[model samples]
Target: MARENKRKAAEKAEEGDEFTGREDKRPRKEKVQPSQIKNKEKRSAVYAKLKHEKQVEKRKKIKARDAAFKQAIELGEEPAQKMVPRTIENTREADETVIRPNDEEFLAGNDADEFSTVLKQQTVPKVLITTCRYNSSRGPAFIKELLSAIPNAHYYKRGTYELKKIVEYANNMEFTSVIVVHTNRREPDALLIIGLPDGPTAHFRLSNLVLRKDIKNHGNPTSHKPELVLNNFTTRLGNRIGRMIQSLFPQDPNFRGRRVVTFHNQRDFIFFRHHRYIFEVKEKKGDPKDKKSKALKEKTPKKVIARLQECGPRFTLKLVSLQHGTFDSKGGEFEWVHKADMDTSRRRFFI
Candidate 1:
């Protein structure tokens, strides 16, 4: 060490001699130092980069593992996704974001829960009103009128064009029964499916109709409300009341209709209905047509009248009052259904 210091001092003196324009016989000392802070910083940066790279590799491996498990379950393997420890090599970590051990696995667990819940939830029957054709020369005015009367009714534009929308909407809500409306071929041309949800909701018949549009109007279609058009059936000549019971009301293995025992509608609430037995109709005090209703004043006792002589007791007609109220406040027998649950994973359903 002494020899080295002597040499370093001798080199500095020789530099001073050169400045004075004299010859010097000594070597100049090296100016660079062995312990500069800049060198230390460069070493630190390299170490940090290596650590961060290792951490990134670990996270990517974890992510891939989680995603595979999720896909396996979705493909019917039944096994589900799980998480495991993931390492990070970096010393400094960000505060806002946490690198999950297995993020995709966490999401998979949530998806499984949703699927389980949806499968168990009961599904209600829905009444569907679809026109085989729309945007015809005549407008859909009649359809509009009935929709006004029935709230939450499903309406669809024809074809597979709007089928996806139907499935999506049905997934989000429930239905009671489906009613399909079509044009009548005869003078009274209206097809209606009623009294559904009592059995399999698919059976409906157009055996009874008012008229044939072709026979009466000669293909001249008229724009009118369906209700008004149905009323025009009264002018028909033949009593062709072939409801096709076999086609419309099939034997159901699971359907037992619900009976309504009581109804409560008063001044406090507007959910009121006419209290009546069979063959009677008590018009509400506030309806516009109540003044013109002769049945309300007639007060006919409950009676059973057989429309056809060749019918059994089951086929006999019992004259009954038409119950009223917007929220199904009829005090009699009715059909009830549970809410419909559907799988929303790109599946198709009838609307």
Candidate 2:
């Protein structure tokens, strides 16, 4: 300790200044002024500017692609394929059989009448809703929500039966459609819609599926079915969601004893509701005088049944439009809908 003191005294004498015990301190960080914070107007303006710039850039790229494709075609070279922001290109060659003399005469005839006749003969759809065998909690809740929207649907919990066997059962029992929910990260995030009796299957990604009980609703039973209506559902996104919902039901809506199902999207949330029509005969005001009077009294007025039950744990989907006709994370023109902004309430707004 004495040697250190002597060294310090010597160093102080050489520098001609007194030595302090404390080490040098770093400078304090400058505080941001009030002007540094961006206000609401400024933020909106900047966002609008950026959006405009992006749109301009996108148009430029599309024009360049069109020009290149045209040039290649003119030069007798095969044009490069592109699949994005558009439907898939038809790559199949024309079949010679379709153009044969026998087929040509038949093709020139009316086919719409046949399609209309078949449509008229279509029957009510019986649907089965299920989830992945491995999924329990999330899948069950999702299935329950869907069932509440479609009260007449049949449900089978996951794992009770094999997929192939279940499909066979549906075919035998004449179930019109089958809906399967898939879970990821302990949350339901996808759906599979299959038509009964060996038909096409469509896969859909269900995103941002938050339940009311998880967000605001408590342990109380939250079932109230309202007369659901889709308002201002006219955009491309709205049309796609509408089609997906429609595919869940049977082709025929005029089936006897079948309830009406409505699915409409405003903003991005798909709303569901069911309705049934009631037809009852009017009561006779006076005693029947003759056979004609009795027959007249039997006639009843037809009225739609009142739909007072309002039920839901409604959900919003994060639409991701994919390119290459695939739902994978990677591929095609993909985008997520931003519906988190509080300024616009999706539920209250129609479009």
Candidate 3:
């Protein structure tokens, strides 16, 4: 009986060991990173291999999609919808301030805004462009380009006068707007646009400046007022800023000049581009087998194509702040101010 008990005890111990072993399995293997590798050559080789594999996978997916599309065509069935890749712009967090098409309040506000007179053609826009008190080397060059770009814009020498005094003088002179180009370290770094009479001031951070001479094969802009194209200004603040920019130019645009000044806003950054477009006719040979082409002599077909030439001085602007009143730095009430903490998420945007 003692021997039987020992045998049963041995079986029970074995079962417990088996149960414990199942519960305490080996930990998962961690993924090895290229940065963790000590050898430079091996790290680089592994990284390249990984990149090649990813490219191959991408190509395979494209090929599969093409094959599926062709099969659908052959079978006379509806093709699968094209997949749109995910991007930050498409996946951005929803914003409540985006203006809708039939927003009556927004429309009314626009009609009664500070820029209404200029936009409505009641008053012509006379802009006064000036530099900071201590101007940089490139500031004057940028100002010269602005003078050409904006109609009836004059450059005033910023000597020892304060900005408040300048704003007062511009108001007295009937200037519709004041543009202060701030420079630092020999570069034009910021732009301050203040609407006159009644107030609303906008400050922008300027970057990626390319002058007229720097652009290759640039066309010279004419003295006629260029057409304005404002795109993607959908939010409340964006519309306000767009109106302010629109107020800098005259209401009527001379389409005959074929010059276009575009302020394209994407991801809250404004891109400024000037271009001269021309339409040209080009002859092309038609298909010989088609009945229409055969009747038209197959070689005399002409197509009109529109081409654009860059009229330079390109730059980008990001809104830093928008103040309710004019250039009173200490006492101004800001409608919106960009802060470091505001950039917590890549998918969040404000305009």
Most accurate candidate by TM-score? 3
> Tens digit of lDDT per residue, candidate 1, span 1-351?
999999999888878897888876558787543344367877677667778999999999889878887888789785543544553322223332232445775445434431222223333224455553434332255455334323235676766444334433444554343344444442113333332322222222222221222122222212211111011111011001111111221122111211111112111111211111123344434546546457655664444532211100011111111111111323433322212352232221111
Residue pairs clashing in model 3 are none
Which 10 successive residues of model 1 have the least lDDT summed? Answer: 231-240
Off by over 4 Å in 1: 1-128, 133-139, 159-172, 184-199, 207-351
Report residue 250 deviation for candidate 2 (angstroms).
7.8
Task: Estimate the overall C-alpha local distance difference test score of candidate 3.
Answer: 0.92
Question: What are the runs in model 3 whose C-alpha is more than 4 Å off?
Answer: 1-77, 285-299
Given candidate 1, what's the lDDT at residue 344? 33
Query: Which scores higher on lDDT, 1 or 3?
Result: 3
**CA lDDT of each candidate?**
0.34, 0.54, 0.92
Can you give the TM-score per candidate against the true fold? 0.21, 0.40, 0.78
For residue 156, what is the lDDT in candidate 3?
95
TM-score of 2: 0.40
lDDT of 2 by residue, 79-169 (tens): 9998746321223223232233445444444233212222243645467888877785677877876775553478986577777677787
